[model samples]
Target: MSKHPGPSLAQHPMPWWRSGYLWLIIGLTLAMLAGGVVTVWLASQQPHAPVAAPPSQAEQGGSLEPAMQARNRTSSRNAKALGTGGD
Candidate 1:
């Protein structure tokens, strides 16, 4: 046996804070959180207009009767016949 008897250096575990993979994971998590915060802030800065309600049936002169249904059916049929619509 050798005269010197000390613990081997290879048996030591690295500190958690010194790990590259751990730092990469932490950086990615922070980046994603920052991106989410920025996205929310930007969305909040957008213009939010009040939606307008559609005219009432009486105000539209009751045009949504059988005529509108017939026109829609005819248009859909024409589109399908022309191969411009999904079958």
Candidate 2:
């Protein structure tokens, strides 16, 4: 065999922290942990207000009549176009 040995047979192997891949993995994990902590803190600081329910048609006093008429007109037009005679 030659006097020179392969890298695997070296007397001292590289340390874990010195590895580029290890550093990359560690950095990504720390960044994700930081992001999660920030998100949780923000969520806790400003909780959403309770939403109010919308009034029903009767409660709103027939405000949707015009919209209903327009919807009926559109339905009849579509039915006529399809030769269904608008029922």
Candidate 3:
């Protein structure tokens, strides 16, 4: 039997540009690049606000009371367990 040459490139049914998948990928990539550019532009246009200074000791009055009480309670429990009476 004689061998057939099979389909040639000139006889191909559809070219690469006509593919829907290729166009979709290209569109998504362009969209992603545009989004990145917009994000960078927005960030550069708006300067960050200055960070607020930590509250001073005078400004923090009774906020630490509960924490201090918990620490004291834990220390007393440990001291009693060790028979040191928390010195």
**TM-scores for the candidates:** 0.44, 0.60, 0.56
Worst ten in a row by lDDT for model 2: 2-11
Ranking the candidates on TM-score from highest down gives: 2, 3, 1
Q: What lDDT score is found at residue 65 in candidate 2?
A: 79
Best by lDDT: 3
Candidate 2 accuracy as lDDT:
0.89
Please provide the root mean square deviation of candidate 2 (C-alpha atoms, Å). 3.8
Displacement of the residue 45 alpha carbon in candidate 3, Å: 1.3
Clashing pairs in 1: none
Clashing pairs in 3: none
lDDT string, candidate 2, 46-81, tens digits: 699999999898797778778989999999999999
Pick the winner on TM-score between candidates 1 and 2: 2
lDDT of each: 0.87, 0.89, 0.90
Candidate 3 CA-lDDT value? 0.90
**TM-score of structure candidate 3:** 0.56
lDDT (tens digit, per residue) of candidate 1 on 1-87: 769866676778777899999999999999999999999999899678989899898798876678777888899999999999933
Better of 2 and 3 by lDDT: 3
